[model samples]
Target: MDIFIKIIYAAISILVATLYGLILIGIVHKIYARVHRRIGPPVWQPILDIIQTHGRKVATSHGIMFFLGPVFRMAGGMGTYLFMPVIFGSVVFSNYSMAGDLLLVMYFIFFGQLGMALGAGEGGHPYSPLGIARGLSQMSTFELPFSLAVISIAIQYQTLNITTIVAAQQGGMLNWTLFTNPLAVIAAMISLLGMNMHSPFSLVLAPQEIPIGPPIEMNGSFLGILQTNRALFASAKLVLFMNLFFGGATNLPIMMLKTFSIYMFSVFIGAAFPRFRPEQSFRFFLRIPTLIGILSVIVIAYL
Candidate 1:
């Protein structure tokens, strides 16, 4: 009965997290529209879009791998969310956080990207591989700084447990890593801008040239699944950042506020800047953020 209850709780948390993610996307769209002085779609637009996409008939398939691309994407998103505690002390929202630590979370985060890359390769679209190549290149570059920053935090706290890290930040806002370890936070936030795939860093999905990039060949239900995964994945990333830097939330509303705010940091930058080429993006991540990440490690080691 205890095991069954845990499964039921996990399902609820995943469902809620997915829904919140969709709403967050809608809010992001609204913000973008406001920035451009144009009327945006309703805040519920993503939900409607997903419903319409799923309702469309898929007339074809590019073999088994193609079909499994969205599956892997969704699995990656769901798995990442499950491994992170949502509401700290809350019983229901904890999910499977105890089953893994920060290292597993990092691997789970990359799992979907690799899976999607494989699926995209199976599509036979020239642009698909091109986008995947650019994405992987950019990922490799950013991962250096991001990984270093994460390691620095782990070393400073002397643990790789997400819950433990958050607990250490309790007491007050100054306890947050964002205040104490500004260098690491800066490195992570810059890497996040690239990870979010927005303007300036959005070369991977260069719609003007690639017509939506990697998932270009996908349509109908498959497209819908990818969209759903996007929401979940984005939210999961925001939550991870919240836990690491801003201190984890103790309730749903605080979680939404912090996550949304962190997400907007990317959106605002993306809206203001022009897109960077793959090479340029890679170099940018390697230069400034990498330097900061290194300094963070040095500071943590000494102090």
Candidate 2:
């Protein structure tokens, strides 16, 4: 009975996170449209898209791996969200937390993308492999600064448990990692621009370069699953970043506010800048952001 209740809570947590993510994406679209002086679809457009896509019949089939790709991607998004506590003190919403959860969360982030890559390879589309190559290489490059920043915080908190880290930030804004270790936050937030795959660093879905990259052949439910994961994965990344750098939220509204604000960082940058060439994007992360990440770690360890 107890386990059953926990399962229910987990399901609710997932639903709430998914809705929040979808809404956030819609809001960004609206914002982007407004920035260009055009009316945009309502904020509920993304939710409608998911429903519409799911209703489509798959016209063709790939192999088992192709079938499993979206499933694995969804699993990766869920895995990323489930292990981290969503709120600071609310047991019903906090979800789960454990030692070394940070590392696991990072792995899940890459894991979902890789799953899609595998499925795309099976897609046999000539462009799928090309897109996969670009996406993977870009991901590997951005992960460098991100990994360093994560290490810096892991050292600052002296633990890999995300809950403990969030707990340490409670009581005031100053207690947040943002203030305590600004350098690490700086590094992480900059790397976030790449992780979110916004302009300049938008190499993976380089529609101009690779015709929107991987999942080019995905249709119907396969496309639906990938789309859904896009929201889930984006929200999971935002929540994790909030908990790590901005201090975890105590309630749903606060969580929404913080996460949305964090996401805006990328959106604004994306709009202001044009896309970079793949090589330029890779070089940018490896040079400045990587240096910042390293400096952050050194500051935390020695200074």
Per-prediction TM-score to the true structure, in the order listed: 0.97, 0.97
lDDT of each: 0.90, 0.89
CA error at residue 300 for candidate 2, angstroms? 0.7
Tens digits of per-residue lDDT, candidate 2, 213-269, equal 788888889988888888888998999999999999999899999999999999999
Model 1: residue 66 alpha-carbon error in angstroms: 1.1
Query: For model 2, where is the 10-residue window of minimal lDDT?
Result: 203-212
- Model 1's alpha-carbon lDDT is 0.90
Which residue ranges in model 1 land beyond 4 Å of their true spot?
Answer: 207-209
